[model samples]
Target: MMQHLIRFRVFLFAALMLVLTAPAAQSLAQIASPYDVRLAYVWQNTVTLADGDGVPLEQTGPSFAFGQGARLVWTADGSRLYIALDNGLYETGGQGGPAVQVPGIFGRTLTFTHDTGVLYYLETTAPQDEEPGIVSFPLREANTALMSGGTGKLAGYFGRFASGTTRANLTFAAALYARDGGLLGPGRPTLWPSYGSNLFGTCCFPDPGLGIFTLGTESYSVWDATFMPGAAATNTTQTYLAGPTTNGVIRIIDLITGGTRDYAIQIAGGLGTIERVAWSPDDTMLYFISRYNPTTPLMLNVETRFPVDTSSADVTLYRLNLVTSTIEQLAWRADVYGISSLAATNEYVFATVVDSNAALINAFNTQQVAASLPSSDALLAPYMPQTHLWRVAVDGSSVADVRDDVWGLAARPIR
Candidate 1:
């Protein structure tokens, strides 16, 4: 039952890895961007590079067969991209280059540090009695693995911070760790699964000249706990970290001073829970996805408390202005599951929305047809929903379907 629940949550976020006919490739000149922005995404089981407009610039040869836990990350300079697939991990040069498989390395949940050029990830294969540990590999020197000393199901690197202040630690699960695997301090225990990890570094960082590294994790008490990295045990303190609670409110901790700021989400009737959040590059605005209300009675261990599960049609995307504390709807699509993936830039916000209506129909048909077969005849696989990747203008002026059947997406750092 535990395995099934874990797999089900993953299936809800990842769409099927289908082989679809690719549209004719277009020249890079077809897109518009000031920094010549590029995006790395998993499209129809293949690793593809696209321009800012979501037009395919190049389709790397390597593809993910299962597309489960498939993730993509770009180097700070946008010269190289690291891709994690079901079979193994692969790397590709910026454009028009064949993806070379990174031998002896296959894992899930990836995070990259710009300062050290090291990629930290959780090992997929751990001893049965032992928990999976976080591992790191220097990008400049590949195939060499170093023990990061801590065990976590998810790992994240907070690379963006104000000048004169730095985040030298990697957030693994609900704790902070130095690059060498030393335990810095502990965060909230509820920071697992999706919403917690999604908002790791979305907002809240040490102010310039604070000379401190900050970390935060979601909690059930309506407010998330913030921590200042310390030797051995973390010293608890409030700092910049913000997200929605189950109570239809979003709260943030000040980065410089220790205080809390609460912004109530304007909703009509039922409670609103913001699931995922992304901060614009300028730090002036925030983009988030929300659900109307979650009334499903799920088991404690299997359900995420922060953003309760709701119907696909009840989800809406919103943006908030930090200066005026105002909220506005950015986009919303009916008959689709909540936005599973989100990333932002100065010009546009990218989101992955799964077609829930189609997924439900597929699930029903598969279950009904398989009911007649013996349990040993075949394993029942969860049907995944169709996924669409959209690039919406930062100002809410326009939205475009950059690609269909995209499971995971990562926008290259343009700064």
Candidate 2:
């Protein structure tokens, strides 16, 4: 009897130890995901953080009045959402968290460096007194509780700023600002395309670790050029990716090795004209939206489709395998007006698609006319293309509408 009782006591002790120590073991293991919000976007002048299903996890007010230029980004850990507005920059705590302005931030474009914990922004020819350049601030300063650390200037006289982990690294247009001081040397040549207007901020999409940036031609002539920052302006071995040329040619350029490959992607009925492109999180695939029309040139401006003329166009989403060179048509939105933007996470590729119909077109035209007037404060409503947020599985399995009347989209960066 005593032997059985002793065994029972030993078992009871072991059970109690597990119950007391299990929480610590779980805490030490890395969290698969720290937060619930997996995407961030702007709709109706509000910035929203959403989950995989497009459910609103947290949101900030109609703060972005002129949200056309506003940039929304989340911290690497997904703890905060930074909304870059024309007026200033602000941050939120992700669950309907009140926004607190990051003081002294006056910039147009903003990008966060995950590894460095730095928030870099483009200080345009703004406020007229301060010198225009690339300025940065530690993200801890943006925290509502600890808004202490001030700003610092990194580089001078740049048209754009972007953070990269691949060979291209940190690119400040016409400037070379390395993450570590002087790693790329001073006065390095830039890859800014001369063929098109300096729309580098919009027309270019950077691969996370691929050392490649996909480019598109927006209302401009398609041209070829070879250039990469931190290298000679032109390398003899370097080949350039032609702009969104005729016949849906997708160019993948290697910034690290100075090589280029062109893929002429096509759909069932005809050729595809690329508008916007996005890179998957793993950097193995690229998601792009193109207009498929065999007969007429349907490449209207991706933005500002004034005098809307997309009646005969069919906008489709396609996934191009970087490893296999295989093109897969994931989702098809036929008879649509246009797709303004494309973004991707590990699970889905989200697009902001505009609906095409005759009546909405007329109202859009009226808004365009009113927009021209300096005194007009008109809202783009009742005819705003019936815009909605859509997500298609990365594996080309399914597609669904996540939200309505949404414009800008971004996938939360996972650290």
Candidate 3:
């Protein structure tokens, strides 16, 4: 209503460094995804449906637990189901029903708008102004009350949206600690020049306006995000995307040639932080999820296996190729160090790894016996990694698992 209360106070100060660093015990060895949990795990239970390499599709599919907000999104064509429990956001179908509850939508990083079912959550009503309110709901059926100026037409469309009568606009390569970050397609609000992280109290995921961004450092808490898919109408920028950009820093906005392309991420083991991206409904490839912070020195003085070493990380899944711009490396899970979630379907590219290698290789070997323990709290070794659900092949060729205790994977969009 006043542009959603000024888009909820500029998404409450660009999500005040991610709602004041929400880590109520999440860091399960850095599992940052399942496409960042947007698919909501679809009412989980260990679903492992694979094909495209790591063969194992729908092995019952369901198994989740990560605190009040257990998601499972779906709706664009797969029927219906928008689960986000902790007692809020619910709706079901696709082979099950009566879960209702979509009124007033609750917290979590939900997103949708492809064919326009309109939903964009992150609300806490009024938690003593700890700031949290950016709601938008509409699944039809006389369930109204998501009005924020009639023509946002579902901000930046996410899954399958490109048939056009004027589309292709979402802008923002800016980052002075982001604000209004960048409005997704439709009109006005295209500001730039806020290059790279410098945030203060991060809780996460904000810097999504299609030209990707997920930059986080909190002085070295390290996280390099940058996502894609904002109603991509192919051409006008680089239809088909990926992130965590670094080949020469970033900036690539061109809403139909408003112009701006500093591009230079020619890739190699130097690209970091574009943790997830998807495309290939003929937009020409671009299945991604790169991330880094490696120090590999395995055995005899081990470097990183997360026995309490600050920047422990690793994750890969590449396939660029916007017509030969080339970049392929299909799958590589170094026993999972981090990667919360990712999903991109045209032919599969879903992920949810957080491996933590049996909770950081143990039996007097973790941190190599906690460096002969003497109590740094026993040299710290509190492992908690377990969340798998992979599927690869956007042309990089198969990489299966399909589902092995998954609590993240919501890919059934396409409109």
- TM-score of each prediction: 0.58, 0.56, 0.27
Clashes of each: 2, 0, 47
Better-scoring candidate (TM-score), 2 or 3:
2
lDDT of 3 by residue, 332-371 (tens): 7663445545666666677766454333345336444554
Pairwise lDDT winner, candidates 1 and 3: 1
The number of the candidate with the highest TM-score is 1
What would the per-residue lDDT of candidate 1 be over residues 53-107, giving only the tens digit for each residue? Answer: 6666677757543424455656656667777553566788765477887764544
Model 2 reaches what TM-score against the true structure?
0.56
Native-referenced Cα lDDT, model 2: 0.45
Lowest lDDT 10-residue stretch of candidate 3: 170-179
- TM-score of predicted structure 1: 0.58
In candidate 2, which residue pairs get closer than 3 Å at backbone N, Cα or C atoms, i.e. clash?
none
How many residue pairs of model 3 clash at the backbone? 47
Superior candidate under lDDT, 2 versus 3: 2
- 1-415 per-residue lDDT for model 2 (tens digits): 0010000001112222232222211111122444566677765446666675565655554343221235465554556777755456777764446677777654434444443154444443331221243221111113234335455443323322233211221111100111111121221112222222221222111211111122232122112332222211111112232223333466665434445677666556664556556677656677776666524333433244233344435777778886788888888776655565566777888887655544434444455434232211223332333567888898878889967756557666551
Candidate 2 regions with alpha-carbon error over 4 angstroms: 1-33, 66-69, 76-79, 93-96, 126-154, 159-271, 294-312, 360-381
